[model samples]
Structures are given as structure tokens and as C-alpha cells.
Target: MSWARIMAPLSGGEGDATALAAAVRLAEPFGAEVAGVYTPADVADVMPWMGEGFLGGVQTTALESLKEAAAAGEAKAREAMSHVTYGKNAFVSLQTPVWSGLSAESRLSDVIVFNGDSARGRGPLAEAFQQMVADEQRPVLVARGEFSVGGPIAVAWDGGKEASRAARLALPLLEKASRVVILAAPKASSRTFDPTRLQAYYAARGVTAEIDILPDSGDAAPLLLYAAGKVGAEILVAGAFGHPRLQEFIFGGTTRSLLAAEAPTLFLSH
Candidate 1:
């Protein structure tokens, strides 16, 4: 069976379990392997204070908090894993303590799922999640209020490389969708990208897609969302873009905006 793993950052919080449970439910149909990812918190106290005597005490506290975060993360992971009883293919593995700046645990997984709670807070967990989607080339699905899976799927297209990548990556789910709406936001300046090319690509892939030219709105994300709701799309697919210089530090406005919107979305970055 085709497998897609659901990975979420484990910071002791309210909806961590809910996010994992939602992933488990989404994975059930594919008999997918569901895994929980833990990236331990970095204690700010690790950096030494001005005086020499203060170093030892600060280091000790930092080490203890790191231990506590790890222990807490592992405990939560175990609890979430136990709740997943759907299939034998599923398992949870805790990541060993690694230094900061390493790649995200979700980079290797098929699809990464993020809980929507992060949108409101000033927490690093949410910040890390935003960076992961914008920086990583992998597809990510952000879960909203409740775990609702399997509904109409919508594709937002500008006939760019990124948009094409999103369509290709989401084809498996798109095939199962009751209806697939391809919302194109074509602009006048782009002569190379045209309707025929976009339609042919989907047709060759055996997707019976219906195309609609998105209205000239100030923003494309909401415009696409509007079309999605019109067709009753539960999942949104689109290409993501980022500023070249701060690409690692910040996600593009469109990707950040969509994730902030808390719609179940799959994004591909160029």
C-alpha cells in the first residue's frame, strides 16, 4: 500500500495528540506508517552569564531543562503512539538528542502535518514549523480545528514550476477526490504559460480536471480558497514561493498566509 507518514513537532501543548490522531486517521486508508517527531527545546540559559561563577549554575539548569523537555516529549510521543491502533505498519520512534540547525524530522517523511494552534502564538515551535514548510522541498499539510480527511481537492495553478510540482505530488490524493478543480491565475505578461499546456499536463496524468480562471483579486490564496469552497474542496494544493535572501529565516507571504488560514493544504516550493 502507498504510505504517507504524519510528522508533527512535539512540544508539550494542548493539540499535539489531536494532530497525531488526525494523522493516524488520514493514514488509515493507505495503511500508512504514522510516526511522531520530537525536536527538543533549546534552553536559552545555555549561554554563559557575564561572570565566571555564573557559568556552572547556568549550564546545570540548561542541562536539566533539556532533559525535562526530552522526557516530556518522549512521554507524549508514547501516549500518542498507543492511541494509534489502526494497522501494524504504524510505529513511533523518538529522535536522539541532536544539536540545533539539523534538518527537520519531517524532511524524509512523505507528508508533514502541522497543528493550526501555532498560528496564534509567539512560540518557537510554530516558528520552526513555518520555516520547515517554506525551506523544505517536501509537501506539508496543516491540520485545522478538527481531524477531517477525504473531501473535495482543489488545485491553484499559475502554470509555474512550483504549481506543477504541487499537482504532481498530490496526484494520489487527487485521484481519490470526488471533484478536482484547477483554479488558474494566468497573467497577461506570461506568454509561454497558457491554458493548453496546463490542461495537457493533467490529461497526460489521467486526471479529469475542470479548469477555471481565477478572478483578478488582490491575493491569489483567498481567491483560490473561494473557488475551493464553491466546489466544496476540503484540501487545497498550491506552489509556494519565498524571498531569496531570507529564504531560510522566513516563509513567503503566500505560504505563510495559507498556513495561517488553517485550510488543509499541500504546498510545493520551487
Candidate 2:
């Protein structure tokens, strides 16, 4: 499928540009419209409340400060949007109550792009990433670090629906890649597609790919990432694998616990 409209949520965080960069890079080959969305905190929600007394001057001052903070975030987001203008269709939107606003916007867009900093308790960005992955179940582009994005894509295949879904969403990038490597974890329990079959599938699409079975290491996810990196891949496409349990996949379930600078930009679909 082609990505005609891409929505990137820019928090103006430590590595927000990675998502913006991925969206812009993908847009060039597909001519997609990139929208840089900013979701700021709600001032009212963070304001202090009295049990049964009227508001005082202190509370009023605190409310104004929170409003200014939110406004400042929006301003920074607007400024960040200026750095990316490759397709002549880049735009920005500052949203409120981050999670709900972004989730709603994601429904209207083809893909949601965000920084892959999914550590628990980090902030709203992490929470939004989890909600979208677990609740929304949409295709997400998690920018782990700086990446070429359009070149040398690696598909972390497990023969499951999630894996195939990720591959499908990543088709535009894969087609444009100088090389595509199908990385498989044979030990993965829920596999469905075989490398030979996947190879033929890509062959029909006029894309040549090399299939390599990763060793049955103790941990499959990190090893899979390791193999993809070894192949000089710039992007790693994988399914957003998740199950209802405390323990999750190596690449992190919807929580994105596995993101790191060393890892390539991830194109994940569940």
C-alpha cells in the first residue's frame, strides 16, 4: 500500500527530528503529504484545585504559568516544523491533551510517526506510543535514531500476521530500498511465513531480497536487530508484537521498550 498522508507527532523532545526525518524521507519517494503535529499538555488538568474554597491568586498565577508552558511547547513545535520542507507540503499542528488528540489524528492519517523513546514513566510521548500500539493498533513509524530511511530496509519476518502487516506497510520503503533483507527468527513461536515463500513473494514484486535465518539465540528480538544492523540496513521493519502479560517481545510490545540509538528506524504494524 502507498502512504499518501503521513502524520508525525513532534514533541520537540530530545530526538523528535528522527520521526520528522523519517516522514520527510519516505515522502520524497511516494510524494506523500507530511504533517508535523504537536500535542501540548492541558493547562486545566494540571492546575491545582481547592476542596470547597474559591480560587485564590496563587492558583490563578499557577494556571497562567501552565498555559504559557503549553504555549511555549507549541511555539517550539512550530519552529521545528520549519527545518523540514522537502515535499513542499509539510505542515504542523499543535494539539492538546496529547494522547487523545494524537490518537484521533492518527485515525485520519496513513501512518503515525514518533520518536522511539518508549520507556515507562518517561512522559506523554511514551504513553501516546503505548496507547496507539495497544489501543489504536495502527501502523507506527518509531524513529529510534538517525537513519537514511529510504535505503537498505530490513524486514524482521516471523511469518505471522503482524510481521506481514509490517511488511505491507513498509512496501513503499522496501521497493525503493537498494537492498531488502528478510530477517527471520526460526525459534519464534507464532511463525507462519517461510523464507522461501517470502522470497518468491518479493520476487513477484520486482524486488530481490536475501533471506537469512538468525541463530536461535536466547533472546530473539535483540538478535534480530543485531542481524539487520550487520547487513548495513538503515531501517528495520517489524510487527508490533504484543500479548497480555508482564513479559513481552524483545523489541518491546506496544510499549516500545526496545528502542535505542543503535537500532535502525522501525516501521511497525500490528
Highest-TM-score candidate:
2
Candidate models: Cα lDDT each: 0.63, 0.71
How does model 2 fare in lDDT?
Answer: 0.71
Q: How would you encode candidate 1's per-residue C-alpha lDDT over 173-253 as one tens digit per residue?
A: 776667777887665214346655766777787767788787665566677777777887777888766335266237445
Clashes of 1: 0
User: Which candidate wins on lDDT?
Assistant: 2
- Residue 45 in model 2: shift from native, Å? 4.6
Task: Give the Cα error of residue 246 in candidate 1, in Å.
Answer: 4.2
Error of 2 at 268 (Å): 1.2
